[model samples]
Target: MVDEASKDGLNALAQAAKQAPRDSPRDSTRRGLPPVHLWNPDHCGEIDIVIRRDGVWMHEGSPIARKELVRLFSTVLRKDPDGYHLVTPVEKLRIRVDDLPFRAVSLGREGDDLIFVTDVGDEVRAGPDDPIMVQTDPITGEPAPRIHVRRDLWARIARPVFYELVEMAEEVDGQLVVRSGGQAFPLGAVA
Candidate 1:
């Protein structure tokens, strides 16, 4: 159960997140992300924001419907030692993330680079800096694939996108591997 003060703080943070794009001259849908890492505000708290496993942003148990708003909020998202936080110049608010925060919804190839576009409009090229990682679920033994986006943030490759990657993979030493930016990332054992 949330206390009244917490509720108020959550609502206020939501409002602030909404207003952030309007406060900026550039469009929130633009490619560049805010300097969230640089901000070290004195005020810190938690809100009801949760990034679901499927990459949907939920607030107070409801989905945040606006794409641009979500994009704006994504710009300020940062991961610290404790957890993920939405950082601004004035305040910092921790948020819950069930899995990762972003989803790699689309994939494209340019030259030798594999470019991934996140749901919130981040374009990350899989390379040494942003490597692809596949982890096996210990319980289900299913493959969970992810790609690094920026800083410590990552985008879970959507199933269809992962299938696309698999389609592009080649068998190398009994393992399925995909090449991007001169790096070979193993998908899994070729079964």
Candidate 2:
């Protein structure tokens, strides 16, 4: 159950997120991301926000249904030593993340670069700066692939997107690899 203070905090966060200044349009790809890394506000406290493994943002035990609101809040998201937090110029509140905060829902190719679209609308290009990494579950041996989205933030590649990548992979030195931004990323050992 959520306490009254928690509820108030959540409401304040939502309001602050909505009221935050946005100079650029809502296009994640074309506009510049908010400079959340530079903000060092005092840690206000914890808020009842959870980003599920499936990339759904939950607040006070309910899913936040507004897509625009989700996108807006995502701009202020930052990962610190303690955990993920929603940061602004004045306040910073820790939030729980079950897994990575974003999901790579779509993949496309632009010349030699592989561009990924995250569930929240950020477009990231895989390259030396933002490389792709895959980890196999020790117990299940299932491949879990992720792509670097921004500073200390990564997006889990969805199963379907991973499959698409596999279909585009090429055999390179006994490994299935994909090239993007002039770099080769290994999918796995050729099987």
TM-score winner: 2
- Residues 1-191, model 1: lDDT tens digits: 55688668756765665544333336443254556666688757787889999888988888888887788788888899999998876789889999999999999999989999999989888999899999997878899999998889999999999999999999999999999989999999998
Q: Assess candidate 1 and give its TM-score to the true structure.
A: 0.86
Q: What is the lDDT of candidate 2?
A: 0.88
Q: Report clashes for each candidate as comma-separated counts.
A: 0, 0
Put down candidate 2 lDDT per residue, 75-190, tens digits, no spaces.
Answer: 88999999999987789999999989999999999998999999999899999988999999687799989999888899999999999999999998998999998999999988
TM-score of each: 0.86, 0.89
Model 1, position 24: C-alpha lDDT score: 39
The Cα local distance difference test for each model comes to: 0.85, 0.88
**Once model 1 is optimally superposed onto the true structure by TM-score, how far is the C-alpha of residue 97 displaced, in angstroms?**
0.2
